[model samples]
Target: MANIKIVLADTDDKYLMPLERKFIDGLEDKADLIVITDPDYLKEYFSEPQRVDILIINEELYDAELERHNIASVFILTEQELLNNNTGDAEANRIYKYTSVKEIYAEIIGKSSARSETLNTKEETKILMMYSPIGGIGKTTVSAALCEALAKYQKKVLLIGIDSLQTIGSVIPQLPFMESGTEKLLIEKSEYVYEAVKTKIINRTFDLLPPFHLSLPSLNIKGEDYINLINGIRDSKDYDYVIVDGATGFTEDLSRLMGVADHTIILAGQDKNAVYKLDCLLRNIDCSDNDRFVFVCNKYRNNRENFLANGYMTNFCRVSEYIELWTENSASEEGVLTNNRSIQKLALMFI
Candidate 1:
């Protein structure tokens, strides 16, 4: 528990004493309760805004005093204020108001815990999506290998393979897993997507939700569906990160995937055709003008040295990172390319 410094703003010492006691009792030693007996004390503390994480206000301070002070603060409100006022919008990420002391404590504690968890790590939960053109270019291999490398950090990770391709079973067979199926969580209808995913989550070092046994390719997913799903998972209080293994090439779904991604790693290999398609895909993107699309040269051999050196293609695509790994089965638990140091550098693009 973090020691939270709080400022209580209310009139009348008799009423203030019980509320202060209730707030302190409700917090359970998680806060250093500082009761401001006088409005002057509120002014004194407001001068040093750094001291308080939360402020409790009564009916008395709602009007001109609140406007005059104009302190940017998290607020705790009485039951009447919470029941009466419906002005606050959920869209705006500010001025969280709690009705009771217990509710206030929970919100502060939960937020504080989340902040602490983020501070303790170099890599936190990242919602990442991998895309490419044509399946032979090793999107599955890259996704699986990346998941393996992510698992090495001992953080909870989730890998969800969008059911555009039905061959995910053949991709990674080493682990005991299940499919969320295109039936439950369609990329078009964002409703109940998380619940569908939650059921199919194969709990392990990294949980995977592969495609279902049945075919449902006609599911026309929209841009909004992808947006909602990505936002839901990103805002989800659980898991350190999310990895989306999407189909090769640009569809509405893929465009939505790239749009919400913190970083998109495009996998390229020795095949000239695959590299050309990847180049076209990278060039066509409208997201970040900066280095958002990381070009990863995967599964390159000695024969592909000239391919990496091709200055025109490199300059056109702005190829930033390269991962040259020997062609192995790359699906087996121990045989996969997660141990390779070069791929670790590529993984840093998401980290």
Candidate 2:
């Protein structure tokens, strides 16, 4: 068995001290252990990358920084019975309070062993581009929903909005203004692009790189710049999925973005004009077997003609995987598509 490097972090003095002692005693000469009780020290420790084999942290202390480092095995310690009741998956490891040291040891060793076996098989980050030629097709809504759903499943996701109009701000209000400006960061050559992206991340769920805050008539971003930006994000290894919400319409920049993506999700509607536009867009782009493409019919209504329209879409699009997102009135009112069960289920399939 490989020796593990473990970090036990918790805030409760009464609970943390005894648990630390027990862990040290149980794993003595078998592993390297570090105990952290102070919040400031814990934050400082995670500021940079640390080779932590296993992280046993309080549920309340879990943050985006932990997720960013790509810790392979994480076990959240909680006192709530409800939280501890659902801990089966590799990502959802949890330990209830007052558990015996032997039980804790078994859980840690089991998860750590599994982590070691697959350490060399880490999957490359997936870049998914969400685009539509037709406007008002709810592309942004679907993009945001996909990010949120992936995050909920413990997958780190980054949302990049390439639309010059900056519609993401309308959905997610009070977005922090980029002091350096998104345009400046992308256009200028810099070695710290990855670090710069880390600082702009919001709520630990996903990072948003919107268009220039200043209202310029048009952005000067070119196709190559967009490619470089996406490449930098992929190389950073900070996110499991990078979702680019491109502007509506088929442009050189959009085509290039799709070329770099591992998967492209094309959004369309049931209307004849939308279908015609989609067919035209498909003809322009060269989507081969290597690049996966999924067709989604947004705002779908249950009717005989609309159902046949979905069948017609497959004939021209040449994509086997097709999904329909029915119009949900509450999706707008809630301001979050994942709140709707159907949307959530659909989003989960993307990952």
Candidate 3:
């Protein structure tokens, strides 16, 4: 709200005026608001590639190339939440059109705060995502242990699961999961969401935000939804870490998580097929080939990986001893292994 620049673009002033009115609080100023309803003028507006913090555009006027501009987030107005376009894909955001002005403005303000880190610290929230090229490779187990280590280190952490099959309840069966009925925290207002989220967060060793309970719901989730959900949680408190237990395989959602994560931990098994899969995964991946990512072989009885496509495995696995903890009864909240051999390095990464 302090330094955000907002642009509302559409073909009708009837809609623009009211929407602009919502943000024009004369007290301290929410943001720098610019409204343009003319298509030709809108074209000229972006003809020079201006810097806009938030761009709210109609679906017809939207393009996939706008992301190249100096924009932090783009909210595309759509008639339906799900798009029927088979050729094009969803952008950073897709806000349902014809919703109440209050709801739409709420989205803009919420996402804006997420982009600007509005009521939180100056340091951006560190999003650490956990992904695996192969399934059943103890991705969630490592995630739980890492989370506990971070918690024990006195870091405010939030672990979110998107495994669709629901492994959270199985892994940490003793701890009570914070329950909620909201669909990815997309309520009417950000203020309400911040307060509601703080209440709904389950705390034991660390905070846990329950993933969508719907079957295969992650498939329908857009990158923007993930961004909003993460930012909304961060807005509740200045979290030191937000660990995402992502799904297996290569998906748009997983790819987006990998791209956005401050540190992405990829888990693989200890075998030839594991090496081949991990090799091919790094070979064709579109994510940044930087130190932000690391590959670990789970269930390491011995050093079996020669290298992935990038060169060498980041490390041997977290150790096969944790395999016994994969049972439904072992990952009990009190039984989580906080004092691990390698996870302490992860805990020190933030320090």
Candidate 4:
């Protein structure tokens, strides 16, 4: 019921004038709207904490200071809905530069109200880890699909790829190849891990920290560092869910990741070696006291008989779900899960 103070910072008159007119016409009595067309003045205005209810600025002008400001909600204005991996804020919501003024008003008001509600009643963020003991089984595909499906439901999602090879770039080509992301967070003490990850998001589907560009068999990230990163992301409160795509095998890094994960999706295929390695992984890793462990059989070919006869499912304590994406052509199709209702249904279990 209180008056909301909103700030619109951008230099383009062609884009700014229309939005300014609409804000005054629609919210004259309800809010105070301040429009700044200069980047320097905007930066100076946000140098200190301001009592802003909502702050909308162009993506090019965004910085950590804007985030440091005590604003109820922040939205980045961009040419496209999907932000580039380098310049966008993963934590903050975004609006298209060419959208209708009514749509802009609705977005600002809706998100500001939601922010107030969230602040008043804090909710837990769900953390899901997609892991496999062996590689080359469509693990990255399933992880990307799950994130996309979750986003389709309007849930804020963050996806972190900890694999040494950095397969997420291939899975989601829209994402930029960052030379250092999670590793930068680890090595540098000045940057915040949550803020760093927020800037590397792609398509609003998920916030991602692309894997380090390392050809080594193992990553330089320590167990404590990995745990700290996860804890930082969980505590950020920017996302509704955090999805991690972990490396294969039972390494210390994988163990630490699973240890903090709320739900662990153990991916396997119909291959005998894959099943055997998965059984070995189950025995070696300590997941007995975790929150939840789900076994997902990817590329399933109606091999229920083979799965049961080979006693593959019996090796694990429980099999939470199975996915049937067995076609040779299905793997090549982009946005397969986003367009497929059946696949989206299977992905909803993570939520």
Cα-based lDDT at residue 4, candidate 1: 56
Writing each residue's lDDT as its tens digit, candidate 4 over 1-351 gives: 566787888889678888888777866766778998888888788776688877888878878766676776778888885532234455577777775565566556545655554223335888888888877887888888887767655567878777767767677665666655456566453337656655655554556665556732454655556567678777877777888887877777777778788889888776677777777876786556424887767766773543423754564545555677645455434533554444555455653
lDDT of 4 at 203: 51
Pairs with steric clashes in candidate 2:
none
Quality of model 3 by C-alpha lDDT? 0.65
Query: Per-residue lDDT for 1-351 in model 3, tens only?
Result: 366678898887787777778777521354687898888888787778788878889989886666667887688888775532222443366777775665566556544554565422344678888887887777887887888867654467888887766667666765553354555454344445555566667786888866445544543545546566677766655687898988878777678767778778777665667777776677767434445766555566533433332345444222212122234454445545544545545455543
Off by over 4 Å in 3: 1-123, 175-180, 187-195, 216-223, 235-237, 286-290, 303-335
Give the deviation of candidate 3 from the true structure as CA RMSD: 19.8
* 177: Cα error in model 2, Å: 3.2
TM-score, candidate number 3: 0.54
Per-prediction TM-score to the true structure, in the order listed:
0.58, 0.62, 0.54, 0.59
CA lDDT of every candidate: 0.58, 0.69, 0.65, 0.68
Q: TM-score winner among the candidates?
A: 2
Q: How many backbone clashes can be found in candidate 1?
A: 5
Ranking by TM-score: 2, 4, 1, 3
Candidate 2 lDDT score at position 85: 40
Residue pairs clashing in model 3 are none
Which is the leading candidate under lDDT? 2
